[model samples]
Target: MQDLNPTGTLHIGASDLEYRMIGSAPADAPTLVMLHEGLGSAALWGDFPDRLAAATGCGVFVYSRAGYGASSPVTLPRRLDYMHVEALEVLPALLDAIGFRRGLLLGHSDGASIAAIYAGGVQDHRVQGVVMIAPHFIVEDISVASIAEIKAAYETTDLKSKLQRWHGDVDNAFYGWNSAWLDPKFRDWDIREYLAYIRVPVAILQGADDRYGTIRQIEIAREECYCPVDVTIMAGAGHSPHREAAGATLEAIVEFANAVLQGDEGARGRAA
Candidate 1:
């Protein structure tokens, strides 16, 4: 297979997923696969992937799931277990289709939960570690409340127009994520059960003032995951740490990624 990094569309399952590669994927260095947030896309990630590749000297692969960015759209009335499907079916297929050798998964918000689920559900040895930013283990009332606010913003404010700049079909991107989270049945959705199965190292980054969820999400991982678990709580930061505290978040992730890729066990040390 060619080792060149390319930006293009991949035909996976019934959808055409959009992705871009940063840096080369050599045998020695592991790649970093970035999964975007609920309303986020590859373009929305901005220069984070580039900065990460330069900082950690690891290849970075970023993609937009179906219904976001330039990818194909999905049907309405998405299942409440949408994240589960993404983890079990779509994510694994994406890794295989991309010829993934060894890599770390970096995910944000909904992406983080999806990454955690994938790590626990799939026993793929190629996945050395995972970096979850603002992950949710179990649904919270605060999460539902904040999601409700976003839905209101989408309708009343220019949030939709702003998101349209990033997503190809803005409604597909917004409603697909919004409708599911706001669904009353989704409150019972929980992935903490999968935590025990995660054998690889896990690093969790969350903001101190996040409106979507509280630190209980992190506690679940520490209690359930037997593997090395590293946690970081950014001071004065909100839901999106990478965006709210970009410098600090980037530094931590770069350090952790380098350590994990180098097979350093002590990298599991916690930070605040």
Candidate 2:
């Protein structure tokens, strides 16, 4: 594996992915690999990565997938199984490329779903745990409605202009995610099977009033997962708890990371 620069573009498969490394390298400390939400990118994470690194004393790696941020653009009308492909194919290559040794997979929204799929599907031992924020196991009526609403907002409002600040191909990022979710066939998109296979501990941070998903997501996880499942429902927060309830969300994640990754030599060294 090649050494990761603090900030650089990694050429993975056909796409060039943008990434940022905060604090220690993977070899020196446990690395938290952060996967952004559907409309989010590395830059869109803002200072959360930096804060996570400082709090846990672990390396934080944030990256944009193929169609997001400064990464390469993807073809229009992405596959309905795009998240599955990303989890099974793309993420393994990314972890290997970054020389990921040990840590948690921290993801938000679509990113969270992808992380869960990888953990349950891939059997990668390097992934010590998973932190999922607003993950969707099955498409809900509310999910499709919210996505449709966002599509309208993106077209009529200045949402596209705002997103352009983070994405090189804003339309590609927006439409790729938006179009796939809004597709009628996507209603049957379910990943509950993946939950049954995840061997590591799982932490879910959810917003109580989230418009896109409901408490049933948490219920599904509880039903399917045999591994230890930790749930925190943030009362006032919405879909993006890391952004909406920054302090409490970080505290929950930090506490879980320290607990699950306590056996990691690098993590122990960092704490010392």
Candidate 3:
């Protein structure tokens, strides 16, 4: 692994995504591609990627999707199927652009949903496994209610300022996600069907006290996915377990990646 500035950018479609690639070269190890939360950016992930790289010996690629961080801004009133677009369109372009041959798709919050959708929808062979942290498989009343509260905080509190530190155009990042979820029609937005087709191993991690979602997300995965799933519900954490329960989250992720990748070379060799 090289020691370099944890900041760089990639041009994907009309968007210039800000990213930081950590750990060894992609050719030397599996690349753990990270997708940020709804209001998250590469910066918001803090030292978790570094910790993950150190723990798992895998290259970590963390990027901010369009409308977040220094990535390109997005048009407002984003469609409810925005996650689908990202999963089916943007993520494929990103993986190809980065020359990803084999890796894990690791996502949090909305990012997790996108990863799940891509893994199940596209069924790409390059993806060896998925690590979904605080994923939402379907719309829930608790989720909407909490998101509504976040909307209020963004207006009445310094939440905007806090988020602006990470997002280039904070409103575009915030409202693009918030508005779509709050939309009446979005209540019907569901990606549970995507879970059934995922062929690779999956690790689902959630905070026990997560205000944004419930254990129903894990139950949905267990019921739907045909692949191996490792589930962990951290006792004292909240929405951001990687941040709130860093030690446990890191340990679980490291173990999961190693186990999944252990026989990858043998499997690929046999297939070839």
Candidate 4:
């Protein structure tokens, strides 16, 4: 595993993912590995990672997936099961590459879905909990509509230019995610089955008025997850609660991380 630096590139297979590390490293503290949204890059997370590291006293790692940010570009028209591929393939290598000893997977939007899939599909004991922000368990009509609208905006409006600020291959990043979701076959994209396999505690932060997904995402998690599930509906917030209600979001995650990591420590002590 490479050394954890404040900012660096991690070469995973053919992709060199861009990453940022804040506060202590995973060897000295429990880490929070953050997965960005579909169009989000490592830099797009803004100061949330820094605030999270300060609040929780845990290392916060943020990385941009392939085709996003400064990462390597992927072939256009991503597969319908791209999230699954990320969860099963990329994430495991990423965790190992980072020398992650103990940590929680924190994800937003597509990133959230990837985290959930990993927790459920892979039995990695290093991960003790999950924090999902605006996660989607299944494809919703609203999600399709919003994605379609964004595709239109990307083509005819300044959305592409705006996104270009974060992504190196702006078109690849936008079209890869946009084309896959807008594909008719993507309507059947569902990952609720993975929820049942997640062994760690899960915390979900949902926006009350998110345009992309509804409360049903939370409902699916409640129904599918056998582990402890904590849900916080952030009122007056939109799709991105950490961006829209930063303080509340940080507090909620900090509280959950403390409780979960402390409990894990206690359990380890008893075992010892």
Candidate 5:
């Protein structure tokens, strides 16, 4: 519902999903598709996306996932494959509908997992690269413990009201992500097997003090991803690097984007 100027809004699905797109560039400028965190939305990005779009000369786009911000709430119970379905089916359809054939992806937390799956499944050469911020390749006990704490905080504190400001309907964003994660059957979820199959370059960023997951998650990603891997860790940052250490996170990502945008511009540059 927010106007992002150059890149207009659109209702993209049967659910009337509304998204905010920012920046304008040549059709050839690499698109930067932003995927938000578990309880995040377009507004929750809090100028991070705009700063990123300005830093890199790429177009930026972000949307509230179903049940997040302005997007419609989930109509039914979600299965374990919810993330996979979003990556494999919804993302592809969204890109095709919006004319984003080639782009670099910037995904945080759960979103990072989706980007990895999409990059591996779709063998498009134009898919450039990925920058995963605090990604989870496998579930960790630390994460579970933190989730339990969060649930407790929600029950006994103002956490729900605080989140409700960002998401008008608190339960939609809260339970949709919370229940899906805490489900007993969800422990079997893992995306590591797809890392080795990812052909595009990947830059994995993690915080040394991340509360959601530990450094082990990024280590798992680096160990499994066969392509060129760049791992960065910000000492004092937590689950949200962009907010915790914006300068460092942006600096690192700008460097990565430059390399990705360089592409074939070195020798046989393909004009788009």
Candidate 6:
């Protein structure tokens, strides 16, 4: 309920970027980093992170990327590489700054895509597992169609003003995400191949009614990865399982985490 933005800087390239971390301080506890959606930030998570930490007994970390909420805002049109930058570059720095060795990744929408990239790219110390909500590796006709509807609403409805409540620079969050996803070149984007390399456990949850992705997206993801993959379709829900059906989604995450931890003990354990 209280404002949850503990300021800390992460050095990336020539710039020192600051992140607003929020949650109970459990420096050594198994961590669970919250990655927000395309238009999301630390503030946008509301009380979900705190509640989740309490549920799992894992220290939760939530931060706004460079240009959302309290973080520095970007200038213009973004790129497909932006997600890569967040995962391979910024995320490692943040984990180090926070003294977290490895944690669970809880990502939604575009955040899920970035988490997928990070899962694939890590060399030695990586997350124990990942819980991706509505993750997409490739663009689909459904995604494009949904994005177009959002653009329409932003231009014609009160949605832009509503979004401004969560983002300090609403335009940066809006156009940067909208333009990149709608870009013609973005259609070929798919992280499933990269995800195949992920050695950690993964649970992909999606709403069967999700306008942005088809069932094929989840099917493809389930097929590519060698790890034990569990894909759940929240029948009546939409793009946001956490928002539309929080109870069911939280139950799924709890079950998934317990399974991963238990499995790790029996196996030889991952390469160190």
TM-scores of the models, in the order given: 0.94, 0.97, 0.94, 0.96, 0.91, 0.89
**In model 2, where do residues sit more than 4 Å from their true spots?**
265-272
Which candidate order results from sorting by lDDT in descending order? 2, 4, 3, 1, 5, 6
Looking at candidate 1, what is the lDDT of residue 156? 100
Q: How far is candidate 2 from the true structure (C-alpha RMSD, Å)?
A: 1.6
Pairs that collide, model 6: 137-190
Q: Candidate 1 on 82-190: residue-level lDDT in tens?
A: 9999999999988887778887999999999999999999988999999999999999999999999999999999999999999999999999999999988998999
Candidate number of the best TM-score: 2
What does the lDDT come to for candidate 1?
Answer: 0.88
Model 6 lDDT, full chain set: 0.77
Q: List where candidate 6 sits over 4 angstroms from the true fold.
A: 1-26, 262-272
Looking at model 4, the pairs that clash are: none
lDDT values of the candidates?
A: 0.88, 0.93, 0.88, 0.91, 0.79, 0.77
How would you encode candidate 2's per-residue C-alpha lDDT over 1-272 as one tens digit per residue? Answer: 87888999988999999999998888778999999999999999999998888878889999999999999999989999999999999999999988888999999999999999999999999999999999999999999999999999999999889999999999999999999999999999999999999999999999988999999999999999999999999979999988889989988898898888887654542221
Error of 2 at 160 (Å): 1.2
Q: Give one digit per residue, the lDDT tens place, for model 3 in 1-272.
A: 22224567778888898889887655556889999999999999998998887777678899999999999999998978999999999999888877777889999999999999999999899899999999999999999999999999999999999888998899999999999999999999989999999999999999999999999999999999999999999989999999999988988888788788886542121100
lDDT of 6 at 214: 82
Clashes of 4: 0
Locate the minimum summed-lDDT window of 10 residues in model 6.
263-272
Give the higher-lDDT candidate: 5 or 6. 5
Q: Kindly indicate the candidate among 1 and 2 with the higher lDDT.
A: 2
Taking every candidate in turn, the Cα RMSD to the unseen true structure, in Å, is 3.3, 1.6, 4.4, 3.7, 4.1, 5.2
